[model samples]
Target: MTEPVAYSTVWHVVSIAIVFLLGLFFCVLIGRKIGIGFRFSVFLYLYHSFWCLVYFWYAGMHGSDAFAYYNQGLLGIDRIWFGSHAIVIVVSFLTSVFSLSYLGVFLFFNFLGAVGYLFFYSSLRCASIGSKKWVNYLIFSVLLLPSVSFWSSALGKDAISFLAVNLALWSALDFSRRMSLMYLAILLMLVVRPHMAGLLVMSLSVALFFDSRAGTLRKVFLGAVFTLGAVFLVPFALDYAGVKGGANIDSVMDFIDKRQSITKGESSVDISSMSFPVKLLSYAFRPMIFEATSVFGLAASFDNLILMFLFIYGICLGFWRKLNPEYGNIIFIVFYLFGAWAVLALTTTNLGIALRQKWMFSPFLIYLCLSYINQRQLGRLK
Candidate 1:
């Protein structure tokens, strides 16, 4: 009986691989339809596939919450609306119906994620920055980042969130699109992470109201106001209402301080006492080469270094000064990145959690840098 079970598992894996290849082929075709050339699409499919494999191995070697999710799926659905329980039920149902091993489920969602990226890539065509040849390369680089691709290719809420967010962005940004897809994306986000869904809506609303092409002085004032209000006001409001188990402002700050203290021993930097800039840097660029204790950390550090360089380069290129809000994409990215960063920097105490949480916003970060270069070159031509 044990031998039969083992053979069944092996058969399941083999079949899943074949199905994944077929799915990837269809995704490549979709990519081709979206002007992503057959070769590039194939490359992306392969690249995303490779990382999905790595994510699976990493989840098994390291500790992952995927097993808990998987076990929850197996235990049957409870019609519960509380705290990711709905997602567990859906995942459980899918795995059960399809007879998916955890690895198979990982591959499947990663495939969905890859498809979502293609849709995201298509939506970029509507943005001012998407026409440049180098922008293509930069976007491809963002797609391959380990934090974006690897951590998001697993079998947990992160993978699902990544896909849902990408699809949502695509639907929201499409120039002449319908609302159905956007609504679906929002529903998925609500089921998985309602707070993030709210944040996304808030960011979009702010972006819609503040056009970037208005006066630079106006943009600066409004941007600063929005940033400060979001960073301080939302947390206080949530805490005051005791929403989502939130505590008062002091309690929240103390909680973050205590968390930093507790996790300082586990490859974490002590950032509790640091100023806001230092805390943000700790979130964005820590685990530097010298500080990395593992191979994964080293890889992450390299990406951090690249981001640092890009930030410096963008500043030198006057990217921040020349932000064009004529396009809706710029507005959305600006709001999303600032809002996400502000909240994360204030609340995140652990470096690892910081890294994972920030992956949701990395594409926009990369796009902001590339868009600066694109706009600068266009200005020269003008």
Candidate 2:
């Protein structure tokens, strides 16, 4: 039995290399088309790969759900209809078909994230909405974000969700193709995290409604339709989140409070007992420079600080007004970030969950900041 496992492990190593190399080559091709430059794309691929390897290595040594997911796949497609089981079942299928090891499964998901990011950036370029320099900088910054890189480079639902969300953005904005990608994205989110799908639609709808350049009647009609959809959708989403019946504001709040209490005793950091403002602060900006107790914590804190500074600088430079444009892609990002944070802050209790979930919103948050910086530069040039 051990011999069989060891043999499979060797094959898994080979498979990982093949998949990674192929992905790297594909990324280089896509990068050139998107004007990302061969060198930069290669750099990002290597950087993200390093983090992924580190994640897998750490997991292997310390033990993690990687093995659980790998093993679950061996059981052959249980709970296929359940969104949470989707990744596990798919990974199992791939592992069996390819004779993959635990490492192989992890590497494959990392590859998905890397490639997903490429298409995501490509869509932004396709939109032709922001300054090239600014967009490029934001992409680099988001890739460098410790939480974004680490959480998204692992083999888990977070990695898959991250890829799906980015792809959704790309498909929604790219415009070259039909809306198939957008629908696919919605389906993926609904399966994995139903609330996220709701937030995605709500944010996009609200942004469109508020666009000053769109016709009044068009905006009103769109707003009404989206609003009705949300009214029906929210309760369904709440049910999926395990909020019990009716899924109203009060029930959601009750769920949050109950979740906070339940997770408070876990080994992770517990801000459940903190004041609401403090809890929100912790969610948005915690593990401050001085508060960091570990290397990872410090890195996360540094990323948060950098983001906070950029936001402040943009405001001080009077770029906030331009950032909140009446028309353009930035508004979509702004609304999405706002919607995601609102939901995450209220419902999230554990620091670990907060870190991983908030990363889903960082790409847009970073983009908005970069957009402001670009506007400031353009204003100066004028």
On TM-score, the candidate that comes out on top is: 2
lDDT agreement with native, every candidate? 0.65, 0.69
Candidate 2 per-residue lDDT, tens place, 49-119, comes to 88898887667666666666667777788765445687777777887788776666677788777866776
TM-score of 1: 0.79
Cα error, residue 50 of model 2, in Å, equals 0.9
lDDT for position 148 in model 1:
66
TM-score of candidate 2 on Cα atoms, chains taken together: 0.84
